[model samples]
Target: MSQNKKQKGKFKQKLTDKYRLVVLNEDTFEERFSLKLSRLNVFVLGGFFSIVLMGLTFSVVAFTPIKNYIPGYSSTILKANAINATLKADSLKVQLAILENYTKALRPVLTGELAPEEIDSLVLQQERRIIDESRLNATKEDSLFREMVELSDRFPLVSNMESNVKLVFFAPVSGQISQEFDPSVKHYAVDILANIGAPVKAIADGTVIFSGWTTETGYVLILKHSNNFISVYKHNGNLLKEASDLVQSGEAIASVGSTGKLTTGPHLHFELWSDGYAVDPVKYIDFK
Candidate 1:
């Protein structure tokens, strides 16, 4: 038998015996190509495309976001939170009212006027509520935006809910009884205890004859109904309607608060007038 032996080469042998050589554009070439882009190009192209977008914002003029308001969806949630807070605040006010009635210095806003300092405090609180509502509304908007983003990968219906009037109430927010309607002393309204910023409602459908702030009443709303009936709302934290505005019955007219001479804790002094005389609200509407 003939014996065969391996021959040594002039070059060094590779330790990796299974190694294979590779070259670009070669028949058997196999390698991953990679590249790193500059930051400027990536920023300008990848991230800046959303900057020049035209739609709701970035325009010279803007429409009210009321178009985007999801009606009872976001605002309801906000109002619910606000109402709960208002209720708790009213509980505190209930405690304060007992002390307030005894303290002549407390000043009745219904029959009197508030000073500049008091008005400033009220305005600040209103602004704070508006801000909180805005923030909460923004959160809802953000959530809607995220949903839109997810839907962008496919197709989806409208992302917001609609607003339609459902029920009509004789009042707005809930509260406690303070004073009963009295025609003898000309106390024509029923007082309900509430924290400053609680809402007030119209007793019936009518046009708003007056809506403004006064020294005697921090805020006031008067509705003129048919059959010579007039509804007056006083000591509001804020007003929803303006003079000569048409409003529906059960529509929110204002927020409950103590701003008038007759007020102690935050409460709504609701009055009904018929043929130039004070009447009781309890006669027509059922309590909530």
Candidate 2:
């Protein structure tokens, strides 16, 4: 117990021992600044100052723009500029697509392939068909002897069919329409007489399902459009696009020519098919 108490006393004394830190004026030999410090006091003061310095460093990086210089940090302006550039690029692409579509629509008009005003005038012309009802006329004796027939098919179910009036169809050619659609004669197309080499335009966006020379129609190009509509341009001078080629509205797909044995002069024979049946092109398209 005595030896242990002696060792403890020596250790405590070493830590509590005071020392003088003094500075003297060189010439006068007088003390200028003096401090009485212990070993324990020196250690505590050094630790406190180190902690304060570290706190200041942390504040600078956390609250000031200098933080952006760190390895993983980014500035606000740089991020905002990046976002703006990406958005601008997307918007420019959309604008370019619209311009391309407009140019395609205006090609035929600028090249004088078709008259521009014909489309507007054709829409104004009301569709009319004269039916010869003379076949319905019956003599008095024949009418009395005629058996009563149910007129079920007379007022047919025409209400459920789709109407093509609202659909926008481009003029396939610009010329005087020579022959109109006559279902009675099995002629389901219109013959437009135009000068040679006149550009023939696609009526709408479609794919060329048939583009080849035929014995009956000569050089023919057929496009299949949406909503089960198909367009046939026959008697063409040449085919610009081939089968399976994608075409936009008003794009040039052929030229006017009388290549078939059936045509008499340079003209375009255009046909429009809806569902499985053939429809009148005059009712849907404006071929001048």
Candidate 3:
């Protein structure tokens, strides 16, 4: 026990031993400065300085923009830009999907490859598939509200139902109807005789989904409106709008012409479709 105590005393003495740090002038042999320090004091001062340096480094990295320059760190601006890019990409994907569906639905109309009956069935099947895929379930209150609205607007001039608002169509052209809509004979459109180069207007506000020339229809312009309504203008001498263009109601979108092979003279072949089934344009529009 005595030997251990003596060893402890010697260790303590070594830690408490003083040392002098001196700076001297070489030529004059004069001490310019001196500092007295013990071993324990030197160790404490070194550790304190090291801790202070670490804290300063941490503050600079954590609180200042300099952290962006360090490895494995990203700038706030870069993060925001990445988020915006992702959102835009998602939006573009949705638009591309809508365009693709429009093209697919209009393909048979443009090509005349499918019968009208077959097209109607195809559209019905697509609608059924969409309904089946949707997982939304309306409450009883919602169903009752919808039924009330439908009943109230059953015979109104301007129906304002959500998702199925009744649209008021404008006269596409002032002319006499030469041929009426007769589905029994597979004639789903009306032929209106008009003067050549007369302005052909849009029936409603919509986006031009198709504007191109076909061998059977000549310059055909198709517009997609709200509530799943589509209007097709055929045998136009010239198209004033292009695909993806927005047109207002009664806006001149084409010129009257009997340019198609099926046309007999200067006239306009106008067709209206609702939820993919061809409807009589005369029921909703008065050309005169």
Candidate 4:
């Protein structure tokens, strides 16, 4: 009886194993299909999957670092500056065009043939007034738009006088130099002593850039000249030129006295700078 039962169980197991199925293409065909995959087939398929996965990981790693190449040509600061400067230059061109038209219109009126004396008087007066207006507009525009256009270009200059390019001393007034131009430590000034007053002359032809008193350099006078250079006269008893005043070489600019914090006595401290660098005044000056 036990053997008969065992034979029946074996027959059931065989039937169950033979009739098992899987569907790979249920939509395409209704025809029935069967497969008997062994352990070796499963192992081969798993190895292929592992190889494909490794290839995918390698590809991802290789391409990741190469994505950042295009925008690295110029720095962010440069790009922004280029954009802003271009816009400003365009605006300036428009402004310049308007100015040019006004000048052109005036040119014809000035060149009209009135009598020499009549034309001279009228043209001179009109030109002077127009020049004054242009100058005022230039000042206003400079104050309003300097920072925006510093990198764009220099203002177009038209003047009767030559450029202020030198500043020197008048009759030698005796004074002890309290401060001298020292290149090693970046101090650029010659401080001279006087009793109450001494004449300060323009070292070069230049427009008065600044003439005022500060906490450090009191009663200062800064002159901007050609060759991208500036001459500074500091610690003055009196300042003669206002800001934007044109000055000639050897023109009186100030008086000698102590008015700033770094004063040893009542003296004049003079300096020369080029392109924001304080150069040795002795190189371009003769104390005698």
Candidate 5:
């Protein structure tokens, strides 16, 4: 027991022994600085500095952008960009779907596949879905205002005529009507006997919604005008306007010809529609 105690004391003394570290100027042989440190103090200071260095390194990696440079770490900016790209892709998909549905709905009309009444019903259904007429009740003040406006505008004959005429259609071709619009026989168009290659004009300002050939209509050109008006020029010899082309009233859009299988001779087979319902073009235009 005494020998063990003696060895422990010597070990303790060695750990507690002070050492002097001196810096000297080599040429002058003069002591510039001196520090006294024990073995235990040096070990503790070295361990403390090591621990502090490790803590600094951890802080830089955890809180700073340097973490992105390390493997297995994701960049915050890149993550945000990825999320934004995903959202844009979703939006594009929705837009493409809407466009596809719109094209599908119009295909029948453009191809003349649907009956006139069916087309009208489709338009009516779409209108009903868009507007709730039950919620459009006019108040007493609104009725009174409408009455006042009507009374004030009643006496101006020319102004009244102009106001009543929402759309003024120009004659598509100056020719004698070979066939008048007779919906009872499913003839919802007027066949105007014009010279072959006669210029056919647009009835009003519109966009050419369809300009293509069909088995029954041949070279057909359909225009979509304001106020939900649509005009179709069928059996055309040639189309001057392509689809999506903008045309003005009285502009030549096609040439009359008996191109379709249904025609007997060269003539302009023109159909007019208002709000998806067939309208007699003779009532609105003077073909002579």
Candidate 6:
């Protein structure tokens, strides 16, 4: 107990021991500044200055953009912006994939690499829309027939009418012409005999207006081009282009096959119309 008490007294004595700190002018030997402090005082002052410096550094980092450089520290606005940008990029990727699929479907048509016609008739049933009306009464039928006759006379099926506007055309297929446009028998199109799975291309850049099957013409595709021109493709094994899709000239739209009741074999029935009138496709395209 006496030794411990003596040690304690010595420690206290060291802490309370005062020292004078003085600054003097070098040449004049005049005192400029002086301070009276103990070792305990010096330690406390140094610790206080260190704490103040640390607090100042923390304030600058927390209140300024410098905090962004630190790990795991981010502003709310910056984080939200990054998230939004990421979502937008993901959406764009999805859209790009759809476009790629759309373009890929047309490549085989242009390249004539077609799959076999083993697809079921129901494969595209969901895209088909058929409308059939029952026959009217005799009196009503006569009236309708008379109206149709008058309209036909006014329009008078004309063949090989020259287009007033100059337009470039892309050949839809490379095949032998089996049939020619003969409007007298109401055959307003040409037929080209091709391989069973040959690709059928578009004659011009256009938006698909119709893509579906019909009893008379199976798997028909119709595109509405510029300058009031419309192109029709019928009796296809399958249609690659869908309605409302924008297609470029020479792009594949379908595969040739015998799909309609009127078809004799795998062939493409192509028709070109100008201003609601059927024109000879041979006049515009060279599908040899």
TM-score of each: 0.40, 0.43, 0.47, 0.40, 0.50, 0.43
lDDT of 5 by residue, 1-288 (tens): 999999999999999999999999999989999999999999999999999999999999999988988998888789999999999999999999999999998898899998889988877676442223356689999999978887887576787688566667999999899999876577889999999988999999999999999988789999999899999999999999999999999999999888877888999999998777777888788999
Q: Once model 4 is optimally superposed onto the true structure by TM-score, how far is the C-alpha of residue 241 displaced, in angstroms?
A: 0.8
Q: lDDT scores for all predictions?
A: 0.67, 0.85, 0.88, 0.69, 0.89, 0.86
Higher-ranked by lDDT: 1 or 6: 6
**lDDT string, candidate 1, 247-274, tens digits:** 8776777887788776787888887766
lDDT, candidate 6, 118-202, per-residue tens: 2334444433322111333358779999778768776543421444333879988888999998765668899999998888999
Residue 279 of model 4 has an lDDT of: 66
Q: Please give the lDDT score at residue 230 for candidate 2.
A: 93
Per-residue lDDT, model 2, residue 255, is: 92
Ranking of models by lDDT: 5, 3, 6, 2, 4, 1
Question: By the lDDT metric, which is better: model 1 or model 4?
Answer: 4
User: Which scores higher on TM-score, 2 or 5?
Assistant: 5
By lDDT, the better pick of 2 and 6 is 6
The local lDDT score (0 to 100) that residue 113 gets in candidate 1 is: 70
RMSD of 2: 21.3
Candidate 6: what lDDT? 0.86
Q: Candidate 3 on 78-181: residue-level lDDT in tens?
A: 99999999999999999999999999978978899888998789876765422221344678999999788868765743444432434678889988999998
Quote model 3's TM-score: 0.47
Ten contiguous residues minimizing lDDT sum, candidate 4: 158-167
> How accurate locally is residue 1 in candidate 5, as Cα lDDT from 0 to 100?
100
For candidate 4, lDDT tens digit of each residue in 155-267?
53322123422234232234565567664354656655677677888876789989898988779889998787788887788888899999987788888778878766776
> On lDDT, who's better, 4 or 6?
6
Per-residue error at 197 for model 4, in Å?
1.0
Total backbone collisions for each predicted model: 14, 0, 0, 13, 0, 0
True-vs-predicted CA distance for residue 96, candidate 6, Å: 58
- Give the Cα error of residue 288 in candidate 4, in Å: 1.5
